[model samples]
Target: MSSKLRSIRAGHRSVISRLLKKFEDIRDDGDEPVNTEELTKIVNNLLKKQETLQKLNEDILENLDEGEVEAEIVDSDEYAYTLDGKITQIQKLILVNTSTLSTNAKDFRQL
Candidate 1:
């Protein structure tokens, strides 16, 4: 994982945290007081952001797949191992976030 990629991921995490906070705030305040239109807009924005992040992660995984082959051919064991670890982490992040976002979508529909 390069420093730049790590930074990008950190930014994504921050955005997700803020979105979750908004959801929590709505729930705590009692959903009745929240404007339905506004809530719909917010959820739509969050879904868009999640989709963008998912695509970015997918791109990273593809790049890593290419690099992994190169690293193996070059006999760079450490670099190959690092790439493997990164691939695993990114896949896990995608899976976890996808499930979370799906849950959020369901909750929004219920409102």
Candidate 2:
């Protein structure tokens, strides 16, 4: 895998770990006048991290090889529609393939 991909994955992991730790801390402090201000700060921090992660994911997708995967021009509504259509097509293909595998398994059992 590329260094960029590795870095992005690592960043995602770090954010998730931090979020989990924050939740654990809150849980451990159970029911004794929870500090609303501190909880708000934690939530805001996580939201910022999530926004950063979204931007990173968008950058990675935008920089992907255009030749290997047809790059969707997120700048246009038509391109967004095309992407949604492609995703639906892929979902249908997966469903069809799964059904075919099940049928094949049944045939094998009958042999």
Candidate 3:
């Protein structure tokens, strides 16, 4: 039972870490034109991981045995909400960037 809890904690950490890294990468890229395809892929992957984490949280809560661990999981779940907001912002940036690029291309052709 302890091992199962440990594994769940580890998995949550891994997903959150990966999600943070991706967020940093997108921000670091700044206003430079990014490949819409790549951005979409990253967003999709993050969404899947987020869904998995959410499901894991539900399972952990349902099978909760230890009182201390429940507090930790709740904290993690709150952080996950923060992550979702950041991810949504990134998606918006991607859409705006793609639109700008397309507009510029059309303008250039009309030059």
Candidate 2 per-residue lDDT over residues 1-111, each given as its tens digit: 335853875676576566547645754665654444555555556556555655665666666676633433343235335434533443443345345456536355544
- Which residue segments of model 2 deviate by more than 4 Å? 5-9, 65-111
Please list the C-alpha lDDT of all candidates, in the order they appear: 0.53, 0.52, 0.71
**Worst ten in a row by lDDT for model 3:** 102-111
lDDT tens digits, residue span 31-91, model 3: 7656667667767877887777677666667776777676967786787888788679779
Off by over 4 Å in 1: 65-111
Clashes of each: 0, 0, 0
Q: Tens digit of lDDT per residue, candidate 1, span 2-108?
A: 34554685587577557556655654574355444544555666666566665555455555656565643343345334444533444444455445456536355
All models, RMSD in angstroms: 12.0, 16.3, 5.3
Prediction 1 TM-score vs. true? 0.49
Looking at model 2, report the run of 10 residues with the lowest lDDT sum. 68-77
Q: Return whichever of 1 and 2 wins on TM-score.
A: 1
